[model samples]
Target: MRLSGGNGDERSAGAAQGRTEAPAAAIAVTDLVKAYGPVRAVDGISFSVPRGAIVGLLGGNGAGKTTTIAMIMGLTLPTTGTARVLGSDMARERHRALHRINFQSPYVEMPLRLTIRQNLTVFGQLYGVRPLRERIDELAASLDLTALLDRPSGKLSAGQKTRVALAKALINAPDVLLLDEPTASLDPDTADWVRTRLEVYRRERGAAILLASHNMPEVERLCDDVIMMRAGRIVDRGAPADLISRYGRDNMEDVFLDVARGRGQGAVT
Candidate 1:
């Protein structure tokens, strides 16, 4: 019982109302596809993130989550289809929207020789943040990096570096945030603290967030909607509770297992 398409009339009607009557989606992807030689990294898939909403992108390795996110960020070009952020086509006009968006990934590292302050300052300057010193100070205080500001980025522990990466991402106060494995290396207590801070940041700023993560509990706690991908296509999507109930599962972990292992196909809707 795979999901079907939506109504055309409703979509047309919504389009007719225009931007003023209905705000534009913060992130919009339509039939997005990406390929490498004979392999299709991301098959045709479409979805959107409304303003202030947090959407989770879930998939096992080789399921296309990273490629999809890269296309959305304009770091990788799609073989076909389109990704638009803030009404700007990512392939042709990402620069227009780049200043309003930010991304954080623990897999992406900062310069090792630069101090935490230096790294923040460099990113802030790139984003054209006004009063850059004050902004850096504010983030250091908020993320508890004040004491580590002068330390070389390479010298910090994994948890400390994760915090600094988050600070760098928020330096511009971006309206669209893309995060990949934001809490990958932190201990349980530190991970919880980081999750709490993210909630506060989203609530206070009304930012649209697209999160790619492997942590089922974290997704269940933070996401308003979840999109599950397998073999480069979206197989199922729904709210966390709705998906759990639909699959007759006790928790999202079970639901994820069903999706990942191709189990319970008759119940997947």
Candidate 2:
């Protein structure tokens, strides 16, 4: 099954020129703030993912990465500011953009009693995916979910459920993909395989991906750019290699620690 919609490839091929002309955004956040009482989970954070880009949302626990993603999904209302998906304001009208955006997280569960195929069918229909059954079959094969398709979602092993969740997320061929711990719980080999598949999918569709994960190597490999959050605010932003050098670290994990530990404070770009 084809993932790339027509014209997306052309735009990606001329990405620089496209930016000069009229840059397309897959996700855009401007001074977005989400406060729970006096505590700000996401405080005045701003960033944008250009179409066809893969950006990492890097942070430690309680660093506000998840909260920001929730705001983008319109699952949590922000205290102030705006988040737009494909030019649609998710705050004001999430419905207009929900069909073209999808989220996958290991922590999120589908209906426990539903079979993998059943869950995919429901989401495909919700997204108004055409030839839905065929789409499901294609995704099952691509994600190696064929054998587990008929099994109840809750009965599957963590690794198996992860694949099913990925399949469900891609059922609609979303233009923007938000992934949280996408390869969590998989064995090393399986985790690598999953990363390769995500890489291919992003390239083929020229889609934008917002990856939230603790795997430093994974972030280094998959992200074109990274945003590091600390204490509910953006502390650093740059390409992974640039950040590594800027922080005088050998890898992203060390850099992540530096920012999370206050060493990288006021390093925002």
Candidate 3:
């Protein structure tokens, strides 16, 4: 089932809520649309990540979450509308704008032959990070990757690799961070550590984060706001608590279940 309306306007309004003195939202999608063959991959979806806020993108598979993130990252073009990264039109100035953003996805592979430290150094240089060694040390320490730095990225355990992936994403000191299933392979303890590091980074740097994950607990624990999508369209969105309250549930998982099952009011069934 598909939602009737899109989230374009809702996202624009949210983006405009950022403080007047701050850089426009770190990320903004306005009336964004993308289609493939007969399916609308992203059906006029929209949202904004205010500086320093952690926003969760929650949905079942094939719901356009990945496609949306790809568009925001300039990895794919939108069929209609626009997306801006750090206040610049992505379509017009993708390279200049993308430099201010970095992404980490568990599904993406880092170079297998490169040692963890070597991989990070390569990416750091590619992003033009100055004092690359010092920055690598800092990220390694924070993500608990100092011990694994010398191990080949492909040889590390799932949790260790996840940490390295996060460190790579932070190498650029980006204003916007896109995380897709960041903690998917992590155990509870390691996942908690990763979450703590991310929280600290956002608090200290005021970076805007867009996280796409199915982990309801992670979303509730980290995100200040949540956008719920289904069948390639946004059906409901709000603060996690607000979504739970609105849906008459005690937790976000329940709310997610309700929406996913097509039970929410005005939602397509």
Write candidate 3's Cα lDDT for 2-82 as tens digits: 111246663343324443343356777888889898999889876667777888988999999999898888888999988
**Candidate 1's C-alpha lDDT?**
0.84
Off by over 4 Å in 1: 1-22, 265-269
Question: Which portions of model 2 miss their true places by more than 4 Å?
Answer: 1-19, 264-266
| Residue 86 miss distance in model 3 (angstroms) | 0.8
Ranking by lDDT: 1, 2, 3
Which residue pairs collide, candidate 2?
A: none
Estimate TM-scores for all models. 0.91, 0.91, 0.91
* Candidate No. with top lDDT: 1
Report each candidate's C-alpha RMSD, comma-separated, in the order given.
3.7, 5.9, 3.8
**Could you give me the TM-score of model 1 versus the true structure?**
0.91
Residue 263, candidate 3: alpha-carbon lDDT: 88
Q: Backbone clash tally for model 2? A: 0
Q: What is the C-alpha lDDT of each candidate?
A: 0.84, 0.83, 0.82
